[model samples]
Target: MPLSERKVVARRVTLELANLVIKYGRPIVVNLGVGIPAMVGEVVAEEEVEDLITITVESGTWGGRPLYGPDFGVSLGAFAVISVPDQFTMYEGGVIDAASLGFLQIDAQGNVNSFYAKDRIPGPGGFPAIASGAPEIYYAGLFTAGKGAKYEIGNGRLKIVSDGEIVKFVKKVDKVGCSSKVMLEQGKRVLYITERAVFRLTPEGPELLEVAPGVDLEKDVLAKMEFSPIMRREPEQMDERIFGHRRMNIKKELLKAIRA
Candidate 1:
């Protein structure tokens, strides 16, 4: 059976986030949040760059492939499994080099709403500590919401069969689970990654950075957002390899990038 569109998008997002490790050019530790962010650890394992990139989970497991869904809090080959409090201590101490988290809503001011909406209240979990402590953060999630949103993937491109009825990027989020003001005060680097586009949090607002292939800038992106994002210049196209079915050979790319 072919992979679902959601799974494909998750892989695309994972590849892009994994590639970010190369930019650091040295060994680093990263906390992978639940949902789409958990997929990054699997990609790191597949690419065999475990030695260069350490994966940590909120459940206190470190240096292993993070599992998702029912196995969400555990790892496959974790080198260490400390107490949950200890894990949080590491996060709060700014020991984590980077973090990738999922978001429910993000506003023009770059505030993230992760775990509360109307009657839904999953609480913030470990998001606050990780978001405020990590020097760099990559917020990953789908571009839109609602069951109406549909997509097709082929030929190294994305096709929006039908856009989601609900827009995630809003003029103001329902709640602020991660505050841009706090992140800025700590000098944290923040980027929001989705299936169709990437944005960087700036003093002005979220700045458009990259758009996926086959996506319409006006129809798919700008039209779907609740507010206009800062576009300093023409946004570059996302890495084409992200849409392809073949392996991206991320390990080779990371090593090459480090050598450069």
Candidate 2:
């Protein structure tokens, strides 16, 4: 299938987030959420850090490279597959360090609506258990979704192909898949990652943390969202490595780290 501009940009976001998770978080057990978040494990596998971080999915597979799309449950190089009950036990016991998942809607309260909308009712799947159990949760998706949604990456920059009609960040969600207030009260950290920007959940709401290169903060990002994010005085620009056609050398570094 031909990749969409949004998917291209989202892949870059996933690569960037995966690198951060490897460096700063260094999670020993991580669950790469479905959809855009699933790419995190693919990038990790490319980086060759499978041994360092146990890549797992909600379907009970562990230490394997996750497959995307319709073949999601299948994996390569998996260490083992446990029963569903055992997997949830691990998740509920706070064994997962981080979970990178997809989102359909996020509200000012940081509540997520990944499942169950007016047109769609796929249900939360394992989102509730994963969201509640993980110490840090990252929601990954495009800033907006609908007709005309598109983008491009070139010359170490990002350009919009066509803006999507729907805004994802809102004042309220149609249904709460994971309650932001409840998660925060448990002292868990939450972050929302988009192709254009990254937002961290604060007491007030989602706070802008970083903006992508060649992106206008006001016109490209803030103006596109339904709700206003708590902006940093000078938000950090997204890593240049995430843009352009260059291949990242994270695998080399991962091998080196392992050897040491």
Candidate 3:
């Protein structure tokens, strides 16, 4: 795959993730974790749902329109900025509607291991507080990491360069940064959205919900996970709109839903 086409797959994956989040609708408030999770805010801005979504950061920025890249820590048109402690109060009090956060490793039990992986960065920051409180949690990231995993776009679907040496979906994570067991017991809705598939947490385990086009459910997804997920009888192919090169009219749809 050419470098240019690889870029296309990368962009499409990120946008697909953002679109996935929008389906949950605009919550009264939400927090977006760093990395690809933060990129979702960029898509929200593009979809013109900033007012509807109200993106928050761990740095005490509430109701701030998220700014990606170098301007990430600051919001473009912020409504308010409070102290760190006050923000924690909000998270701990279960005020956030949803929290979209990054993932390193996840297990059958839904435990996440984003903080203690070797050969990668270590730190949970405010992930625990955000995940524990948010009624809905979207674990956002690629399906594979390390090794030589790469992506390309062709035939309206994404192609993998090489299956990465490391598989992110494991039987047990290196450490439990956020306890999926606790969240599941509390009856929170937890989802793992990757570039190729989506899974929902269930009493049994992670349940397969959707898979991207051109991906093999058995070869690409099921084969890579350390534990077998509960396969939906008829798992849906991710929507075609998720692969488009242009921004979707999610703003219009969201506004219409609000009015209705």
Candidate 4:
């Protein structure tokens, strides 16, 4: 397949994520969210992450590599698989350690709105349960949409860090997919990972932990985010080691297997 600029960039984002999850050392059940992160599981699985982390598909299968082609396949290097029927059950109830999911919008309350795209809203399928109930959640998406990169963080609820800026990170969520108030109380970790920067929702609100390597704070990442997070020391590049050899880049593998 010929590579386009968009595809190349998207793959970079996926690779970065492959690095992020591995840092945690394959948790018991890494909920492979749709899109890039699913491929990340395959990448990790081909390597040793599978031995450490049991990769579960939204499907029920527990220990088989991905079979890609038939289900609108994408290739990945993973070990073990399951049917989607079983996967959603675990998803709806709660048996996930970390979820690398995407979102269309995120507000100060830490709520997410990924289902509401223009033509249709898929309604929140398994989102509320996963976002709210998951022990660890990582919200992943692109940094800037065509929205021109600016907005206002209204002064309704939480006493926050900043207001009026670009979007996705906010002073309060417009609707509650996940609540910062609840997260802090429960002590579960919620991360905001984007192509532009990485932030964490803490008791203090969104804190800027790291920017992708070679990206600058004021010049690149910070200015793009709607609000300024409390930047800790310069953020480091998520380690590539996370996507060890065998399992790394499993997308193609799964897709190929399913096709075969």
**lDDT (C-alpha, whole model) for all candidates:** 0.83, 0.77, 0.74, 0.52
Task: Pick the TM-score winner.
Answer: 1
Off by over 4 Å in 2: 1-27, 251-260
Ranking by TM-score: 1, 2, 3, 4
Measured against the true structure, the TM-scores of the candidates, in listed sequence, are: 0.92, 0.89, 0.86, 0.64
- Write candidate 4's Cα lDDT for 54-92 as tens digits: 555555555444433254223244444556656676776
The 10 consecutive residues of candidate 2 with the worst lDDT sum are 1-10
Model 4 segments beyond 4 Å from truth?
Answer: 1-27, 46-48, 65-89, 92-94, 146-167, 170-174, 232-234, 237-260
Q: lDDT by residue for model 1 over 1-260, one digit each (tens)?
A: 13445445456555644556666777778898998788777666666888878889999998978887678998988999999999998899999888889999999999999998787756999999888778889898889988888887777788888977778999999989999998888898899988889899999989999998999999999999989999999999887766766666777777787778
Tens digits of per-residue lDDT, candidate 3, 1-260, equal 12233223234434443444456544457787876677666666666767777778988887656765566667766778999899999898998877888888989887888778776677788888888888888888888887677776545576666678989999999999988778888888888888788889987888998888878888899889999998758788775555555555666766665665
Name the runs in model 1 displaced over 4 angstroms. 1-21, 257-260
Q: Local error of candidate 1 at 38, Å?
A: 0.8
Report the Cα RMSD per candidate.
2.1, 2.6, 3.7, 10.1
- Which is the leading candidate under lDDT? 1
| Stronger candidate by lDDT (1 vs 4) | 1
